[model samples]
Target: MAIDVRIPTILRSYTGGSKAVSGTGDTLADLLTNLDGAHPGLRGRLVTPEGGLHRFVNIYVNDEDVRFLGSLEAKLNDGDTVTILPAVAGGALGFAAAHALRG
Candidate 1:
């Protein structure tokens, strides 16, 4: 199955600055492998050493979160659009709330 992967700005370097790239696979994991073959070093940033997805990154298949869809085992179809987004840190507000609650 041919899939369209939307690359985030930070990871665009792997695709030679391309915002979107195409790959093929039956599952999300296969798609990543296909992408890595064409764009070396890209998979490492999204997947962990144990072969699971990295917590810092979020992936969605056609607007649905892959995590809720069996993660790496998520099924994909041809022409599906895969979106990769880096998790936004809560930063200051989160830190302040945690500190206040601790007190």
Candidate 2:
């Protein structure tokens, strides 16, 4: 089944700057495998060496967080849109806000 994968800007390098790509897999894990085949190094960024989702990466299938669904084993169907986003936080603005709050 063909699945649509939305690529985050930080990981666009792996997709040759494409914001989105397509692949085939029955499960999320299988989709990653297929995507990595077309775009080498992509899977490594999403999946840890121990075969689990990376701590800072968040995946959503059909607008639902995969963590609550079954993680890598989450079943996928045709035409599902998968969005991959890196958990973003901890910038200078946050630090400054914390300092202001303390004062």
Candidate 3:
């Protein structure tokens, strides 16, 4: 299946500064493999040596968190959108401060 994978700002270097890339795979794992073939070293940042997603990384398929849909095993289809984002942790006051800055 042809999939559109969205790359976050921090990882754009691997994609030659492109924010999104196209890859082919039947599952999320295959997608990453194919992606790495074209964008070498990209997978290492997303998957760990243990063959699992990095703890601080979050992956979504078509707007749904893949963790709820079998993680890397999540099935894929043509035209599906895959988003990879870094997870952030902060206390309520920290969040308020960040949000206040946006005002």
How well does each candidate superpose onto the true structure, as a TM-score?
Answer: 0.87, 0.86, 0.85
lDDT of 2 at 15: 94
Give the runs in model 3 whose Cα sits over 4 Å from its true position: 90-103
* Candidates sorted by TM-score, best first: 1, 2, 3
Using TM-score, give the best candidate's number.
1
- Evaluate residue 21 in candidate 1 and report its C-alpha lDDT on the 0 to 100 scale: 98
Candidate 1 residue-wise lDDT, 1-103, digit = tens: 6899999999999999999999999999999999999999999999999999987799999989999999999999999999999998777567668879999
Q: Provide the global lDDT of candidate 3 against the true structure.
A: 0.93
User: Please, what are the lDDT tens digits per residue for candidate 3 over residues 9-84?
Assistant: 9999999999999999999999999999999999999999999988679999998999998989999999999999
**lDDT (C-alpha) at residue 40 in model 2:** 99
Cα RMSDs of all predictions? 3.4, 5.0, 6.7
Between candidates 1 and 3, the lDDT winner: 1
- What local lDDT score does residue 55 receive in model 2, on the 0 to 100 scale? 73
- Model 3 poorest ten-residue lDDT run: 88-97
TM-score of 2: 0.86
